[model samples]
Target: MGTLGRSGIVRKPNETMRMLVTTIIGVVFGFFIGVSFPTISLTKFNFPSNLIPSLNFTYMDNAWSSVTGHRQVNSLSGVPKMWVETNPRGAERLPPGIVTPDTDLYLRRLWGKPSEDLIIRPKYLVTFTVGLNQKTNIDSAVRKLSENFQVLLFHYDGRTSEWDEFEWSKRAIHVSVRKQTKWWYAKRFLHPDIVAPYDYIFIWDEDLGVDNFDAEEYIKLVRKHGLEISQPGLEPNSGLTWQMTKKRDDTEVHKETEERPGWCSDPHVPPCAAFVEIMAPVFSRDAWRCVWHMIQNDLVHGWGLDFALRKCVDPAHEKIGVVDAQSIVHQTVPSLGNQVSRGITLV
Candidate 1:
């Protein structure tokens, strides 16, 4: 009877332990099935329908809201519609219909203009990068550009004060940063949205001699020919690299021309046809918007950009040309390339 009683006690505990283990295994298996096949309705598991609503099935949505502090609205199909976040600090927001100032305040301060005053909007905008040593060349170019275009100067030498020596400098918006390439400055400063008001944009090197180039005449020819990407014809003896860019007396603008030995033979190809060297290229505001996107942030010198300029304008041959009517001499100065810092060329 004592042995029978001991056996009964052990059997009762073993049955209880088996039941407990079965319950845990059932719960783990259900959880895994629920995760693995989300399409299965919770109601199929005999769970109370009301319990499903109380539990968060959209954990991702809840987590996203918690981290961003933004409430997300989901469609009946469970797709997110929009995310809305409210500023808890209660800072005043700008009222509707107020104009946000787009002009760079640092550039304005350099121009010695009041912060409240609006910048003078010009029909044409010209930009160039210069060193302190190239003041003479810049002075000539700025003088020509200032006649019809609002000039913006990017001084690589960082000598903003030295520009005071030139009379035309007073008319320009000057920004100076030391030892950076023209493309580097251009990427940061010449955002298309900011300069959208201008009809044309001329981005040129400071070394170009603009004695023969007329800013007014150049615009007239560009508008006449509908040239979206163009440059002044380089004089035949002015270190002529491309035959297409060299001046031709027969026409005002040439779209296709004979290329040098290394240039592409196909008239449709660039750096041979529909190409202007980046040294002194003019862009229509629309073309500038597209070209600005092509300028890589790390490619400061813009070495191979000429080949890609055709991508910005369709029928590039028709829209891109050399304006021989307003030719300019490329002095080809190595001013920017000579600046070496820590055995690396900055230009």
Candidate 2:
């Protein structure tokens, strides 16, 4: 997990709760007497507080409800550090482990980068860009993505808050972009200190939600197909246009034939929607280097970025692949209009 901002330094974790109180007597008496419950600060909703303010009668009743809904107390002696439980949406319980050597070998072959002898670890760097004076659901979106993959978020603002708790524990580094300028955001992506350390980079918009995302598998697929540019799972209803091809063979209709149209990229695999949505797209070092060299220094802001990058990558011929297995839900609003008038026509 990671986050960045204007303070120029990664923000520190907020202090833990200063107080905690659990009283059966007070709870029973208050329940019978219908007493007014205590109120909690809005900041406390995101941060830990001294006491868990009234779950019975507080404006933050929802928060109280969520935090205390379930509690399981179990005492097991000398459990292995590697043990973990599955907290899936439903059917919550500790599942079995992949104890087979074949499973371990598959995992190693899938994501592990080449290391001495036999150790393999995937290398990745995640980059996020935020504009100043913006209100967004990005923080929550990022938190969800960080559960399985290593993530780093860059914020334009410098304010520290309790909501940043996950970043502190997850290893997200907060870097100040000074201003919310697109160039600054782009610059940090290429900053030697940042780029030199990672093998793969995933750049994305802030408002993207990954409902069933798994970065390890994502990378594995990318490498397996030998693609330099790859996109996350996409759905056609998401408002992005894709070029698809239709195959016709009426003479041979088999039982397996559903009589449906299939879609795909054009001969020159240029992206159908925005190239590099700046949200949830992964690029190999080879692709990033290709982009870095082609970016025109003067082209700094948002207008022509998508256009310039597509041209830079020579997308029509690159090993650009799209994954249909997983989908990232982008919470994007309707675009006002095309901001730049580059003469390129959309085929």
Candidate 3:
């Protein structure tokens, strides 16, 4: 019977066989040592914290550490992990701390005075689209509107110096941009967010005659009727096509008025009710925000915007109206159009 070897294989008991078995065991052990030596050697080298694979943090964790200037410690491992600290505070305090009356006077200089004094801001604002040639008409309108309204003139003629001729111009803000349309100036300059401090905004053309319009009375009617969007009534000879805009002697304020046949079936719709022509539109601050967004950036002429104004206000019929008590005449002068066309052709 043959004897079993250590590997449970039957082998002949020869010197050559024993020598071959010992050599095979040495070769196998040496191969494992060679493979493990490089890994052990790599652990001895100290790499940067960022290069270490196990120390990497998630994007959110990194962001939190950067903003708060605190390192994210591993809760489970209880190890101090390396992280970015953007606003590091190392034995230093932040300035402008707790602004109380007892604070040092030198430190208080960095902060402005407390809000104890009353600041009287303008209640209403009016923007007039004016040309240099219409200075006479603008002066007349400003004279009547300046007492109660904060006037802002958008001079399309590019002749800003001409405003200096009128003494009332001292109270107005004149912005002169040449050859641009009224709506163009309005979109670029009269943002609702900037003008939110005012209660009402009047966007009127320069040709309008405001002899009959009373700024104070108009605001009173607007508040009483709860009109978010409104305009003064146009005189009969104002060349206005909409019947709702025409001056009504019977009522002080009218939301819905008669229009030409087939103009609008629903009286609650625009051009009949819940509408005011763009020539002289007044908007509440909240309504103006919506309307300012609705004004297309490319549509500079603003011809079709009046029809869409009602969409910005809820229950448009009640909130939008024409105040007959504060009426004006739309001279319907084509001077702005004529000059703009000429300027474009010249360019």
Candidate 4:
């Protein structure tokens, strides 16, 4: 695993990956602690004399990153080499393999230009939690998004290869696990650093109908209105629980929609104002960084998150709303609950 930057540079493994390096650092540091006030300087760094004022922790952190960030471990000639972990430990452990939290979906060629040549960073990310039955819906939705958006599908039904029929499928990312919610997959795989390249992120359910939605146009409205957290207004339907998300056909967006009796004590509060259902919410890059941290591992998808999304942005009421000009039909498919009933449990 190499550390990748937007510049398309994939750091080669740390060349000085010898146990002697570890042993030397450990021994030198131990000697410093042994002494009452050990001061070493750059002039006498080889043996550690009483000249250095203090340790440069920044240098040490870089060293640690070099040692742990990549798979390369023992280099006899102090020359960095490319390596791949084909037989991985899988998810039995906390991180399976590698300490780095960032990753991408670019397929690598065995022998060609440097891996950096493969970086085609997209400006946005649109993720869907899907099952086999929702293929038609997801395919249609993905087609509506421009090439600037990266497509990531979380396969809860464990069916991924079937999506290869689409030409775009060759470029998208797919993560398949038997039965899990999109929130779970987001927390685990969509680390902020991994998706930092994108300007916006769409974490949506697979049952959305994008027939009238244009991802690029939706983004334009989100930016034009200075919205940090937003969603496409829901097409008129009986399944809606909040009028705040319903499409207002005459407007570009609706920040404050009238709620039913006693549903919202304050018109500016959640479930009435600053509200967009979790089913199809779009978050700015900075907003998602904060929202991702707020997600609890135990939270079942879409149960109570729609209200708290306002916390991620400044001026919540002004920045959170529904874009009516670009909207989608929520199919109200039973994905999480149906999968859980088969085997998984809430408790």
- TM-score winner: 4
How does model 4 fare in lDDT? 0.78
Q: Give the per-residue Cα lDDT of candidate 2 at 65.
A: 35
Which has the better lDDT: candidate 1, or candidate 2?
A: 1
- Candidate lDDT scores, in order, read 0.78, 0.47, 0.76, 0.78
* lDDT tens readout by residue for model 1, 97-121: 3434344322344445475454554
Q: Candidate 2 — which residues are off by over 4 angstroms?
A: 1-122, 131-140, 143-150, 161-163, 167-170, 178-183, 240-266, 269-278, 297-301, 307-318, 333-347
Off by more than 4 A, model 4: 1-107, 114-120, 337-347
Candidate 1 — which pairs collide? none
lDDT of 4 by residue, 7-62 (tens): 98776557335555898999999887767332222222354536655767436534
Instruction: Give a tens-digit lDDT track for model 2, residues 101-124.
Output: 111111223444545433433367
The TM-score measured for candidate 2 stands at: 0.46
- TM for candidate 1 is 0.68
Question: Model 3 over residues 221-317: C-alpha lDDT tens digits?
Answer: 9999999999998988898468888888999999998777889989899888998898889999899889989888887668889899989998998
- Candidates ranked by TM-score: 4, 1, 3, 2
| Residue 246 miss distance in model 1 (angstroms) | 0.6
Error of 4 at 193 (Å): 1.3
Q: For model 2, what is the alpha-carbon lDDT of residue 140? A: 54
